[model samples]
Target: MDPQLQHSVAESVATVVISHPEKRNAMTAAMWRALPPLLGELADDPAVRVLVLTGEGGTFCAGADISTLRGSPQEAQGLAVRAEEALAAFPKPTLAAIGGHCVGGGAQLAAACDLRFAEEGALFGVTPAKLGIVYPSSSTRRLVSLVGPATAKYLLFSGELIDAERALRTGLVDEVLPAGGLGKRVAEFARVLVSRSQLTQAAAKEFADGRTDRDAHWAAQARASGDTAEGVAAFLERRQPRFGWSVPTSG
Candidate 1:
């Protein structure tokens, strides 16, 4: 099949599959341009409480399709950075359910997500060095935040692939599962995310991403949300809290 971002929502979890299996699921230029709008749609859907990004088959993504880099490198990199920023800014919880190779642009996208779970034996790399192209500063900063300066330098400098075990130890991935188990584990965790309060998740995400100016805004949201009351009542009454607040739609 042609390269595309295929998405579906089930049980309040939206799964976006990068489909370009012929090239190890490498993203073409068109695919990069397509991502932000697709994410916007999912982000606006009240039914979508969480999102899971993964590859179409065994491989998560092999990186950008090199053949599409015939244009100005800056133009291509700009598309990727915009897509990465969009994913990072997504209001709800987002997870990368990774398997096989996650490299270059693929690794950039995964790092944008709030969490990453990789299948054992999966390989990851930031490979712009291999092509003599400079990685974008925003992408570099995100990588540094996830795996620290030294580890980020190692990946960026060497363009070498790291195994899942090393990635987990360095904080690149939150969890590592055995082969064939990634799907089940991601589904279970996504359900857990869906059950929680979106108000709390949205606020925490904003704070964690370093937007400290929203303290009063979130405080006002909590007061108006009624989620706090429902949570307290649920604890005292021995029932699950039905959290009614949804993330406010972006203008």
Candidate 2:
């Protein structure tokens, strides 16, 4: 199938699938350009509490379609970078479900997510060095944030493929599961996220994203949202909290 970005929702989680079996789900320039808007639409959906990104045919993205690189290298790079930034800035929690090859730009997309889960035999690499090209500084920093500077340098400098065990050891992946049950596992986690208070999740996500000055504002916002009261009531009543709040629509 031709490469495309498609989304579906179930159990309050929007799953974005990258499909291009012929090329191991490598993204075309058009797919990259489509990502930000797709993510935006999902972000605006109040019912979608989380996002799960993955690839079809057992592989995550292999990278940008190199066959098209020679024709519009600059455009492809720009679109990919924009898509990465959009994913990183997505308001809700985003998870990458990696099954097979996640290399080059693929690694960037995975790093942009809030969490990453990979199958036990998945392979990962950053191949800019192999192509005599430079990795984007922003993506490099994100990689460093996940796996530390030294390990990030190792991947960038060597462009060598690492197994799931190595990726987990380096902090690149949060969980490693046996193949065939990845979707079930991710859905379980996403359901947990869906049941939680959006207020708390948004505040924590903002902090984790490196914004520290919003403490007072978030505290006020939380009080106004009434999630705290509902949570306390539910706890005392021995029932699950029915959180009604969603991220406020930005102006």
| lDDT score, candidate 1 | 0.95
Regions more than 4 Å wrong, model 1: none
State every prediction's TM-score relative to the real structure.
0.99, 0.97
Top candidate by lDDT? 1
For model 1, residues 183-217, the per-residue Cα lDDT tens digits are 99999999999999999999999988889799999
TM-score, cand. 2 vs. native: 0.97
Prediction-by-prediction clash tally: 0, 0
Q: Give each model's whole-structure lDDT.
A: 0.95, 0.91
Q: For model 1, how many clashes? A: 0
Provide the global lDDT of candidate 2 against the true structure: 0.91
